[model samples]
Target chain A: MDTDSPAGRARGPYAKSAERRRQIVDEAYRMFSTRGYQASSLREIAGAAGISLSNLQHHFASKEELLLAVLERRDETPAAETAAADTAENADENAAVPFDAAMVARAAANERIPGLIALYSVLSAEGVTDGHPGREFFLRRYDSLRAGYTAEFEEVRRQGRLRSGVDPAMAAASVVALWEGIQLQWLYAPDRIHAADALRAYLDLVIVSADDEGADA
Target chain B: MDTDSPAGRARGPYAKSAERRRQIVDEAYRMFSTRGYQASSLREIAGAAGISLSNLQHHFASKEELLLAVLERRDETPAAETAAADTAENADENAAVPFDAAMVARAAANERIPGLIALYSVLSAEGVTDGHPGREFFLRRYDSLRAGYTAEFEEVRRQGRLRSGVDPAMAAASVVALWEGIQLQWLYAPDRIHAADALRAYLDLVIVSADDEGADA
Candidate 1:
């Protein structure tokens, strides 16, 4: 085999170690998504990854560390996509889509990644309690998300896209709240709840198109 | 003191046992609210209640069973209040308030009981995982809430209270989702997130008054 080939280069200890870590994270993600954080044990994850408990502990000192790794991997996948999209030639054009509309679009996209949704729904809820390893992650996540949303809503309001009587700050909070609530419901009853549809409904109520604004006036 | 006087009679073993059980549940509720379900241990709860581990176990066989008792107590508190109001002389008049509006009122009420909200937010989110002890409770709770909301929305629509272009079923689901989502956010940042305000805003968008409906038509 050619030494330059990806498979031929896998013989090194460093690469093997990295590959093993990736396998552990993948197994943790799967187990966390289905069994949740507290219920899924380190032994089960190590077993699923075809590694011994000692090896897993060497990679991740504790289950909390492994959980953080799994969550980080989940976040990176989307962050990477967004980063790639940001560099695309039509990036500026893509920015024309309003934040609320983009949110609805993302909710639709989330349907295909139910495992991530399951993991998020479980951990974020679990994170609300004191001393949960994921608490700070969620607090920062929610704070940043709400701040980003508030700024976007302000911009939309400035463009006269928001309904005349709507308050941008409240609207921002509502959107975030709506997304979280709808997704939680969706997790409980996926067949019955429509996350994207509910999101779009809410957006339509608060955000008006230029044509609709003209008609309203 | 007379033997038949309220405070004069010596307490029976049954009353003492009931009081002890109540103490355990109360302590469990407090710990569960702040520390969350998974982070809280039976030993700590037992200690907080000033009972030994064996005695605590005698009253409640498992942590899951204790959790159920705590949840049941929480539910009963609200149910008791609502029941009192239901039998009030003006109960018919109170029924005139739309379901969404009542939910906003409840959100405001929930602010005074942040501990319950914390407990609920943690468990409901955690319950999304498979085989969680609270899963059946949350599943039934959400189902009943959604159904109630839908029925109430249907009535409101019949009375011309729901805004035109709003579907009752979606509106019902949205209201429930909004409550859950906003409350979770409130748990994270109590000072910043206005649960009632967000809920009322969403409700106003979906459920308009007679005058607003007339203007729309």
Candidate 2:
């Protein structure tokens, strides 16, 4: 009984299971965001998702597992987009790179994904302690992102796009830090600030291109 | 019944009380840093401090109160130092301000403060929801910090020290965010990163001086 079988398509148990998981995750995210992880209860999550406690447990095993799944799903969105951008950027590495303001603008415009951003920030801070599953995940996530940005910086440096004495690894770390930091603040007071504008301003200060000669040295 | 009377001065109740409070905070910090607020218990904290539960409650009214006091005390250290630096820097506002490379270097050299930093990171994330005492504290702290940095940035801008079109408020927010973000990464892998150096590099790129005119525009 494959869920996608043509005969079982209308009465597919797998499809229902998948939909139930999505519904649970969506409810959990809302509850966690509004009530926080400690204060939110599994019963409430189940109630909000319109499922029985047994049904919820059948899908998720435990509250922690459910929370992890929610986080994983949220993280996948940006990871996929960033990966695609990296691949495209890598393909054009040999060519005289045309300034891609549109691509940067698109990433910047993703400021609307505040819930997912907030989820990551909250989970990351919570994950710093030992034995937290997300601890390893966050550590590896940052390492890979830092490595990717550092490699991009090095590539630009090799092409003579960077100024002398500028350390690419350090700069990449700082940029990532700035992005995460602003996201934290934005989570607290979304109405008072624009994370996208803040990020763009930071990028403008650090990243230099052949087209822009007189940027920050 | 003065505890510091000549005979009791050597080991007085008052002195003992003060010592006990310090011991409690130190142990609380350690426990909170490792186990987090929700996971850590008062009995455990008292046990760690080598005190009775009653004595621990005598020092701090409640677990929440103790956590607040511990956090407040921790925040005071950096605020005091920053205030002193602000006063000294403001005194020479007209002069060619010397950058405090040593201060940054000292921060970079020290890796022991990651626990304190991680505690704040975790609490701040949890504080986003309503009813968390730390929510008001962090919100006010950020507001005041942003105001101070904004004023400083405005003064520097008036003196023609920074690039044009840069918003002081946004820049200040970004700076705070970057600082917190770097702290998060450092907490995860203290052995692998120099957060202070990363911060300094980013600051160097963002901040320009009147006397230095090397492609800042």
Top DockQ: which candidate number? 1
| Candidate 1 segments whose C-alpha is farther than 4 A from its true place | A1-11, A78-93, A96-98, A213-217, B1-11, B78-101, B213-217
Q: Give the per-residue lDDT digits (tens) of candidate 2, residues A78-166.
A: 54333212323343443454323432454465466655565676678878865665677778778886787777767766666665457
Question: Ten consecutive residues with minimal summed lDDT in candidate 1 chain B?
Answer: B82-91
What candidate 2 gets wrong by more than 4 Å, as runs, is A1-11, A35-44, A47-54, A75-110, A158-164, A209-217, B1-13, B50-55, B75-103, B158-160, B214-217
Tell me the deviation in Å of residue A22 in model 1: 1.1
Q: In angstroms, how far off is B158's CA in candidate 1?
A: 2.6
Residue B143 error, candidate 1, Å: 1.4
Model 1 C-alpha lDDT per residue in residues B66-111, reported as the tens digit of each score: 9899877854564423321112122234677645556666677777
Question: What are the Cα lDDT values of the candidates?
Answer: 0.74, 0.68
Give per-residue CA lDDT, model 1, range A65-174, as digits (tens).
99889877844564423321112122234587656656766678777777777788778777876677888877887776776777776777777777767777787767
Q: CA lDDT of A119 in candidate 2?
A: 63
- Candidate 2 chain B: worst 10 consecutive residues by lDDT? B80-89
**Quality of candidate 2 docking, DockQ:** 0.56
